[model samples]
Target: MSSQPTSNAPVLHVQGLGFGFPGHSLFQDWSADFPAGLSLIQGGDGTGKTSLLRLFAGETAPQAGSVTLLGMDAVRQPAEYRAQVFWRDPRAPWPDTLTPLTWVEQLPAHHPRWSGEAWRAHVAGFGLAMHLHKPMYQLSSGSQRKVLLAAALASGAVLTLLDEPLAALDKPSISYLLQALEAEARASRWPGRAVLVAHYDALGDLPWCARIAL
Candidate 1:
């Protein structure tokens, strides 16, 4: 890893990252610096985009190397490292009886900087208020995704990772997401925050601070 930073101070720094499955290698000795702002990780399906996000989330341990967010090392100080990072696999299973409203209500206890106002506003904006009380298993795929969308923006985590956020979203919801992301950048709020989205294409024409190809 280079001791010099070519850009702004990194919110997330990856050095010598190496990982892979049996008989199939994905990344080896990869290093990069992610500064504060929205960054895109673009690649085709099955190209290890989700795998990389999992690595960053500390959900999957890397075979070798380090993932550092803010200043905490994912391997050395997991509890403190994850505290400032928000990453939820959209396809992850939920409790049978869990409701979006209840689940979201508990997020703040885990994420110190979580914003209730942002959550409520996004819930309303995404038309998810009507389904908040319903069981997660009962909600439509699109509705479920909207819940994650709302939470991601409201979390206020220093590092936020969303893999394929647009996967099952509705047209209006997609439009709202684009607008919300753009507004987030324009507001210049959370300059220390780094939002990374894994997608096959750019999110509209929004000005992305960085783009990494997996």
Candidate 2:
């Protein structure tokens, strides 16, 4: 992993964040500042990693507290804040008929920074060139997961939210992904930040990584 220095200003800030289901609390009174660069959030299974990501992505509201992306309150300015973030969940449902290229193009038109070539490159790096033409549902789980990851990285958004990124990949693919992620951060962007939620130990070796144990 390259040893690049990151800035002190937070690209993502969670203050007083709390979330839970009907009876139990997942995380309560939580706070964190994701400084510009890569941050790995590690926790055991059923420890609310996905729930926390959902709250951070604005997919669901937290019971209390707030998230700020690039200093813009995520709850107050969701549309604006979302423009700077890309959240990827491998299990997220998508129509079976959606092709990889079509899905990438479907990203909101408001994000003019999305790069088609970058996406193609990422897919190609994963040996997914042939699979792109196939419907998403026809591909194996690993292929579908790769597409999700490629789309998130290609978004060109400032803050990237990845849940279980290394679940179904071999060493070569994981290395390629790490390289791609690093290149994305070094490239020109509004506020580069990557919040990778994973149980995989290999992610800790990524360049400019900061560990957040929850």
Candidate 3:
């Protein structure tokens, strides 16, 4: 693993970022500085929470301005920038034929800090151990979400972008995820490591290093 950058430097820096759909504009000259640790992106529906995450993840390009992740241009150096982050869109379609275990096993190869033991532990912690072999289409919504969460947490990416992370989660699973996120923050294995969570509902007692509302 590479050494972490200075704590004072922002892990993610969005400067004058602008994006819009065909008929609606999401952000106009939006800017923010996200330091290491957990940050919450809270907003109601139609507020572009998911779009913002996609921009940060380099999955969507900004119409104007720039995004810098760990000193790399998010647009110009997309591959290098994205390689340091793990982003999973809840609304994105998945391959229904693949089993959760197979998906998890394949994703980590791209992540330099991938840990097989961590992946298995998160799978069990999120209550997906028994359903690992089942095709994704067969798993319940919550179970499918657990599979994705397990993969993201185990990826060990410096930047983790989670869109609507708390959606469809039961009480126990929510608690488990919260604990895991807290541990990730404290460990700080990657100096510029950050977890950016986009959600519309009240987080209620969850720990957050910073909070931004759109």
Candidate 2's error at 9, in angstroms? 2.1
Q: Which stretches of candidate 3 lie over 4 Å from their true place?
A: 1-3
For residues 1-214, what per-residue lDDT tens digits would candidate 3 score against the true structure? 2346686888888999999999999999999998888889999999999899999999999999999887788888888888888987876677878998778777767788877887888977888878988998888888888888888888888888888887899999999998888887787565567889888875776678888999
Prediction-by-prediction clash tally: 0, 0, 0
What Cα-based lDDT does every candidate model obtain? 0.86, 0.75, 0.84
Clashing pairs in 1: none
Q: Write down the worst ten-residue block by lDDT for model 2.
A: 1-10
Give per-model TM-scores: 0.94, 0.87, 0.94
Candidate 2 local lDDT, 98-144, one digit each (tens): 99878877884745667777777888898898998799889888888
Cα lDDT for residue 141, candidate 2: 81
Which scores better on lDDT, 1 or 3? Answer: 1
What RMSD does each model have against the real structure? 3.2, 4.4, 1.7
Best by lDDT: 1
Sequence-dependent TM-score of model 2: 0.87
Pairs that collide, model 3: none
Better by TM-score, candidate 3 or 1:
1
RMSD of 3: 1.7
